[model samples]
Target: MSITVSLLLWVICLSCHAWLQPGRYGLPPPRPGYRPALWGTRLLAPVLALLVTTRHDAIAGILVWCMTASLAGLVVACGLCFGPRIIGTDGRRVARERRP
Candidate 1:
C-alpha cells in the first residue's frame, strides 16, 4: 500500500515537473495561474510520499521510495518521448512523412 502511494506520488511529481517545461515536450504552455500549482505539486508529492512511506515502515521506507521513484520516473520519461508522436500540437495524431 505504501509502495503504491509512493509510486502514485512520484508519477504526479514527475509529470508536473515535465509539464512545467512545456517547450521541451512540445506541449502548450499552461496558463500563468497554473504555474504555481504545478510547482507546488512537483515539489510536494515526493515529500509527502516520503512521509507516508516512513510511517509505513521505518527500516524499508527509504528503499521502497527509491524503487518506486525510479519506476515512476521511467514511466514519465517514456511518456515524454512518445507522447508528442501520439498526440500533436492540435491534439491529433501526428502524421508521419514517408521517404523513399
Candidate 2:
C-alpha cells in the first residue's frame, strides 16, 4: 500500500515537473494560473510521499521511496515519449505549433 502511494506521488511529482517546463518537452506553454498549481504539486507530492513512507518504516521506507522514485521516473519518461504517438499526435506537428 505504501509502495503504491509512493509510486503515485512520484509519478504526479515528475509529471508536474515536466509540465512546468513545456519547452523542454516541445509542448505548448501553460496558462499563468496553471503554473502555480503545477509548482505546488511538483513541490509537495514528493515530500508527502516521503512522510507517508517513513511513517511506515524508517530504513525500509527510504529504500522503498528510492525504488519507487526510479520506477516512477521511468514511467513518466515513457509517457512523455510515447503518449502523443499513442494518441495519434505527430512530432512534427507539435514542433510546428511550438514555433512562433
Best by TM-score: 2
Encode model 2's per-residue lDDT on 29-97: one tens digit a residue.
679999999999998999999998999679999998999999999999999886652121332334323
Q: Write down the TM-score of every candidate.
A: 0.79, 0.82
**Shift of residue 62 alpha carbon in model 2, Å:** 0.8
lDDT of each model, Cα atoms only? 0.85, 0.83
- 96 Cα displacement, candidate 2 (Å): 11
Model 2 Cα shift for residue 35 (angstroms): 0.6
What lDDT tens digits, residue by residue, belong to model 1 across residues 4-75? 999999999999987887765556678999999999999999999999999957779999989999999999
Question: In lDDT terms, how accurate is model 2?
Answer: 0.83
